[model samples]
Target chain A: MRISPTDVAQVMTLLHDDPEFRFLILSDLCGVDTGSVMQVVYHLWSDATPDWLRVIVDGLPREDPRAPSVTFLWNGAEWAEREAYDMFGIIFEGNRDLRRIYMPPDYQSFPLRKDFLLADDAARSPGQGVRHMEQTFQPAEYRRTPVLRQGLGSDAGHMAPGIQTAELASGEDPAR
Target chain B: MTTEQTVRSLDDPDLFVETPGTIYDAIPPLPPRTEREAEFYTMRDGEMLINLGPQHPSTHGVLRVVLKIDGERVVDLDPVLGYLHRGVEKICENGDWHHAISNCDPLEYIAAMFSEAMPVMVAEKLLDLGVPRRAEYIRVLAWELNRISSHALFVGWLALDLGGLTPILYGFIERDEIVEMLAALTGQRLLFNYLRIGGVNGDLNHDFLSRLGDWMGNALKRIEDQQKLLNSNEIFVARTRGLGVIDRDLARRTLLSGPVLRATGIPYDVRRAHPYSVYPELEFTIPTREEGDSYARYLLHLDEIKQSIHIIDQVLHRMPDGPVMAKVPRLMRVPPGRAYVSIESPRGQYSAYGMSDGSDQPFRLRIHDPSFFNLQAVGLLMPGNLVADTMAIMASVDPIMGGVDK
Candidate 1:
């Protein structure tokens, strides 16, 4: 069932404390960036229900998504909340140790956000008229070309200008 | 200058003075990041900190715990993780639906079948696809075999960590036989990218069935031999029994699953709880122990191996015949929806949560690794125990760093 971020603590408490709907086990807690909004999804298990009860805290602002911590109900939620915070930058407000779990403490960006492009993603989907690496590659022609020799010569010149060109064993100069 | 003058120059007070800082000082001081870290780092009178592994063998993988010890007893511990973090979830979300299966394989390397099965099952849920009965049987067969191999390693490693060398050799022998059987079936040894979205990648062949037939004949005897080697060994019993005891309440509070939870007298197996695949048809018992100690957990692993073998036998007997692959499109686009599927992995409930936005690629993929949950119990269990018992407790918990860090 979908609930507001504010009702997370209240609903979870009722479900946990109420004997009628005893969702004792917090199976999973994850953060999702849905391009437009942020969501904190909680999967709870109980003897009362055969299926896992999924509680989605929907429509938290993407800029600074905040969800009430469920650590009070289950201690295992602490690490899961930390992981969510680390990957998506969604703050679990009541969690005492809400530091980064998987990333370094000084890590700047939340990697799971839609805007956070991976290092290679930029080269794969370059903007405007720029050709992507996959688009430019023709394996058959690439193999036929002496690209490695040309690249090595240019790299050597760029790296050390003082190096003299040496003659090959076949009496051919690389400078030619 | 003379030798005496040179020696005097070298020993000059001004020259001998340490510089305020150097190029090496570029690395900033990493003070405690969280409340737990700050508390653990602050040494009290007679309390010292012990940093154990990002590199220790007993840690299972790259997990480092900062143990605060007051003499021999552990005061508190702060487990520092993320050394093996590969950002698998983000990578899965970026790839196509099919790519997600292969990507999930490395999340729990030891039980790659379950890891691969998670995404496939979740995707199947999203698409409302049905797997063939034969495929379901095959999946269960593969899963049980994988479970046996994983539990074998766990049993051996736990003993090895406690300084017994023989059990691990027996463990590897059992593991190798099963792994080779899998390799024959899947065409890969470690990371078998065998599970597809609607069904399994390949069907059972002659080579795989012949190997399975041969192994099943002596599997029980071999398992018994391995168990007899360490089951009543005095040192093994003394080290493991009554060590790192987790009560029923603590196990529930921490959301512990698999053998760890089973060892706590809670007979909560995912196969029985939420019947999936061919488990509903297959007859196998969920074993439980009342003790909730390290020894109980170890015994539970052996019990589970037998149960898996029993399930495998039933699967082989009732094997159905049909096409393995379903009619999934090359570029499969799932309708906008969210699906979650959790299966009983060797260690615990390995779950995958997927969100699709009417695209080939998933919007988000969340993997709930049970090892991550089970590993947390170590912090609570280790506080009052001796420093040497740390390895024993951790080994019993059996947190694969690959899953923990992921």
Candidate 2:
């Protein structure tokens, strides 16, 4: 079931209170950054349902995503919401203890956001001047040795031996 | 300037101001960032704050708890987490589907089989893959053995934390045997990345079977001996009985599963509640205790060991012969979809939610670790207990910090 951010608290309350759909256990609550939008996903388990019922609070904007907290329904949601906030920067409104759970309190950027590039990913792009070590620095001498060139070789040592030192020095990939 | 004038000038606000310390401060007096922290930091007339651990031995791992106490009794506690956080979810999203399984291995380091299994099962679901019967049986066998080892350590640690030492020695003996058997099967002892997306990595071999058969014959007897040592010990019972009681409603509300929830008499085991991975085909029982105290949780672990042994025996008897590894592409990309898979780990329900965007890598992989949620109960259970009983309560909950901080 997909719910709007505003309807999260109300819909979750209904699921918890209704005898027919008593999803008493909030099996999981997590934030997902799908590149297009931020989503708060809730997994609820109940005897009533054979499998887990997934409720996604979809279409929260990437910037300053806010969703109602379900801590009142199930207190276990507290840490889960904190983790989501810590990783994805989605504020779970009404969670009294809404602080960073896994990240340091002073962490500036949400690590799990789509836009948050990992150090290596941020350092170089596909066609940029910066190249991966394997792409640029295959040793010219190591390639000359036959036994070392074929089987027991590091990733950087596996390039074609025919490529000249000048090509390797210029960081030009003959394979590409 | 003269020495006296230099000292005075250095002390002057205009000349030199005090710099606030960073997080590394021995005792950071920084302002509280949240409501709970502010409440726990504030001291009443007779109350004082005691920092339990980011380093205490009984904390199991690097878990810090700020305890507000009035004399010997704990008024409140705020557990400060993130000491073991490795940004596992983000790392999983950055890697491909296959790498996610191995990356998850360290989440529940104690029982890594379940941690690895979660991602594999979720990826299988997303890919709509069917594992062979022999492979499923192998997976279940590995998981049950891992469960026994985890529970054995839990028994030992709980006893050790409460000041008894003998039971842990016995606990380690039993754990070592099973772990050695697993090492023969999985190639690594602790972080066994055995479960592949479609099936397990290797087939059961002669060495693994012989070791398992040898252990199986004596496993029950060994556990019974350990039980004899601690089950009726006056000191163990005195400390654990009626301590850190979590009622059924609270257990449900807190989403406690496995033995802790079972100890509360709910009997909500993931294997039976939401059956997965050939568990529905297997035979076993969900053990429960109505007392819901620390002792009940302790006894539940012993009872669970017996049940796991039973499951293993059944698996061996029903073991099928076939190729273990399924045919999967070297570079696999799952269809764009979302999948949530939960399994009954020794601690509780270890689950994973995998979202694939028709790419080799997952868009997001959320791991719902049992220890993370189980640790939350510490904050709920600690208040109103004596300061000394903190380790006792925490041990019974058995929250592995790797999982909690992940």
Candidate 3:
């Protein structure tokens, strides 16, 4: 139940190996300040066994906010880690692909940080602007990453190594 | 009409290229475009971007997918939330105990009644205020009606998504009745604003009970009529039957609750698991279906409607009357502690978390929204289905954009 910080990859492996933990729903991840230092947290659940388990793994912040990505194990964990990255700035290593989610592609800073602020709410450029409800816009200011014309021609994102693109879609199983 | 299609000015392709957002002004009354496509083409690497909501209408709120799509099939789907975040957590952080419900209830519009009551019940536990017996019975009555109404709309929307149009109107017709019944007492229909700090804001009258009893007796037949309309229609069955299934194993693994979980054959109803109000006193079965398919989920809603009506009938029969509110200090305070109270809402298990610094206002409040858990199941069920089935799967989840994004 308790996974050591360095063996985080093993944590995901063990979860997959154990049939009981069939689906580990990565509920919410946050960085809780434990007074002197900070700890990156993970909340994983198994409905098969009906248990909500908290798998806490963290280290010094100067190093990348790295941890095992459960995207390979549970389909539900795909976005949760991305959210942790966007807000708490956690770097989930071995996650074959990673990208800015929620904020504009060129967002300057993660908004959920303890010391994060909001940028102006105005659509400055097409694709650069984060349109909420297609109403008031937030201009992606001079952020670290450059903004791209979003939703242009992109279809889908990452897939596990062995999974075929077409196979990993709905209606592939006619019986289903 | 013509052999090809109806005439309209808005459907012109040239309008999209030459005059975006100006389609409303064109005089020729083009056929309304059934689908709007806006792809943010031309991108570079290094940045991670995805679409959350545009794929499923369920995420019309702040939820967007931070997609790194290799093709139509998602290689990576990162749900970007807080875009619709109004900081309900922060607001609850700043407000007093009684003031929090004003903000919390609206977050989950589909299950607002349950959302409003769960917070107050958790606060009551912390405050050690025993609600009067009359208030207890009334709470049960109100919640039962609300649950039935919420389920009815779910029935209609699910049918609509699967291409059965008649049930939508039938379901809406039933929903309007409950809204009217709830409205007569609380004044407003949707956001009841019924729960006060110690007890409910108002108590039910005889007229509401009489109408409720009559409706409960006849509602089953009305619901069955809805079923006959589409339960076995070939296309409806084909579109929904085995698709978007979250197997029993996957459902429990994700900690999925409510009808969605029940559809997979687990009887984890919060009312049964952790009883509050007068639910423990009532006798009713937690309707569950063994198959995890969309058909199972669809059938489960009908079973739930029957269960809710049965519960409402019992509440009316046994509801004892007295003063609704229990006595409490005008300036409320509680010993410093934490209490988590969960209830079976229309969607699923909804709970409120409290950290009391022994003050009138909770130092911290975290709500475990049911839709948040249910919607996440989309990623699990969505794959392997064509783009068309996406909406059907999403509509089956019966999410509130406000609830999911919040």
The best-first sequence of candidates by DockQ reads: 2, 1, 3
lDDT of 2 by residue, B1-406 (tens): 1222223455567543334344533323334445554444434466666788899999999998878789999998878899988888878887888898899999899999999887799889999998999999999999999999999999999999999898889889988998999999999999999999889999998999999989998899998988889888999999999999999999988878889999999979999999998899999999999999999999999999999999999999999998787889999989999999999999999898988899899888889898988899888998999888999999999999999998
Model 1 lDDT tens row, B205-233: 89899989999999999889988888889
Q: For model 3, how does the per-residue alpha-carbon lDDT over A79-165 read when each residue is reduced to its tens digit?
A: 456555654567666554354444444454644443332333334345645533222222322111112233222322322234333
Interface RMSD, all candidates in order, equals 22.3, 24.1, 15.6
Instruction: Rank the candidate models, highest TM-score first.
Output: 2, 1, 3
Candidate 2 lDDT (Cα, 0 to 1) = 0.84
- Candidate 3 off by > 4 Å: A1-176, B1-83
What CAPRI-style quality would you assign to candidate 2? Answer: incorrect
How many angstroms is residue B205 displaced in model 2 relative to the true structure, after the best TM-score fit?
0.8
Error of 2 at B293 (Å): 0.4
Reference-based lDDT, residue B180, model 1:
91
Which residue window of length 10 is worst by lDDT in model 1 chain B? B19-28
Q: Which residue segments of model 1 deviate by more than 4 Å?
A: A128-176, B1-31
Q: Kindly state the fnat score of candidate 1.
A: 0.39
